[model samples]
Target: MPGTALIVIDMLNTYDHKDAEALVTSVRKALPGIRTLIGRARASDSPVIYVNDNFGQWRSHHGELLQAALAGHHRDLVEPIVPDEDSLFIVKARHSIFFETPLAYLLGQLGIERLVLCGQVTEQCVLYSALDAHIRHFEVIVPPDGLAHIDPALADAALQMMQRNMAATVCATDDITLDATPPVAEPDAAAG
Candidate 1:
C-alpha cells in the first residue's frame, strides 16, 4: 500500500516582498485550516513534508531558513506551523517542489503515491507543484482553505486548472480524511 504525504510548500517565507502585506493577510486567514490539517495528518501518522523555497540562499540550511522566517513580519504564520521533529523538510530552488529537489526521491522512498498539498502563493508554487505531481503520476489533493495567495482571482484560476487539467481534488481541510491507512493499489487512469 502506498502512503499519503502532506506537502506544505513555501510556508517558511520572509514577507519582505512588495506584495508581502497582502500575502501575509491571506496566510493569516488560512493558518487555522493549515494547523488543523497538520494536526490531523500528525495524528494519523501521515508524513508531513515541508517543501520550502531556498530564497536564493544556496548556503542556507533548513534551520537558518526557519529562523529567518520566524523573525520576519508574519512569524505567526510560520511559527505555529513549523516542522515538528518527525516532519521532513526539503529545500527547493524553484516554484515546483519536484524541480531540482530531492522531494520526488524522498516521496518515492517513503512510498507516497498520494499528496495533500497546502501553503503559500496558491497561484505559483502550489500550482506548479501540483502540475509536476500530476505528471509524475501522484494523486494530488489541494485544500483551498489550507492555501494562501497573492491574488485571489489568479488563485481561483490556478485551482480550476489543477482541477480540470491535472484532476487534482480541490477541497476544504475539514472535508479531507487524513488517515494513514495504506492506499489500495488500483489500475492506471487518465493523467490528471
Candidate 2:
C-alpha cells in the first residue's frame, strides 16, 4: 500500500505581516494540535513533510528559512514545531503547495497516496493545497484543530468547501490513522 504523509504547511512564520495579529491568535490555538499530530506521525514512522511559504526569498533554502524564522521575534511559535532530522521540507511561494513546486513529484517518488495536512492559513494555503491534492487524485485529510487562520468565518467556510467540494476528510488530530490503507484514487471524469 502507498504510504501516508503528514504535511505541515507554513508553520515557520515570523509573524511580521499586517494580518499577523489575528493569525497568531489562531496559530497559538492550533499549535498543540499540530504538535500532537507531528508526534503521532513520527511515532508511526510516517513521513512528516513540511511545506512553507517562501516569504519572497527565492534563493533561500529550508535551513536558512528556518533559522531566519527562529531569529525573528516569534521564535516561540517556530521553535516547537521545528522539523526534525527525519522530516522533509518543501518550499512553496504560492498559496497552493503544488503550484510550481516539486511536491507532486516528491509525493509520487515517495509513493504517498494519502496526505494528512496541518498548519496555517486555512482560508488560503491549506484550502488551495487540498484542491490541488484532490485533483491529483490523492486522498486529502485536514484536521481543523491543526489549522490557523486570519479570519475564523472564512476559515470555517474554507474547511466546509474543502470537505464538500474536494472530498477531504475533516477530522481531529487524535482520530488520524497514518497506517491505514488509503482508498484507491478514483479516475476523474471531468478530466476526459
Which structure among the candidates has the greatest TM-score? 1
Instruction: List TM-scores for all candidates, in order.
Output: 0.92, 0.91
Clashing pairs in 1: 165-192, 166-192
- The lDDT values for all models are 0.91, 0.91
TM value for model 2: 0.91
Give the RMSD in angstroms, all C-alphas superposed, for model 1.
Answer: 5.8
Per-candidate RMSD, Å: 5.8, 5.9
Model 2: CA > 4 A from native: 180-192
**Alpha-carbon deviation at 77 in model 1, angstroms:** 1.5
Candidate 2: tens digits of C-alpha lDDT, residues 104-123: 99887777899999998999
The reply for model 1, stretches above 4 Å from the true place, is 181-192
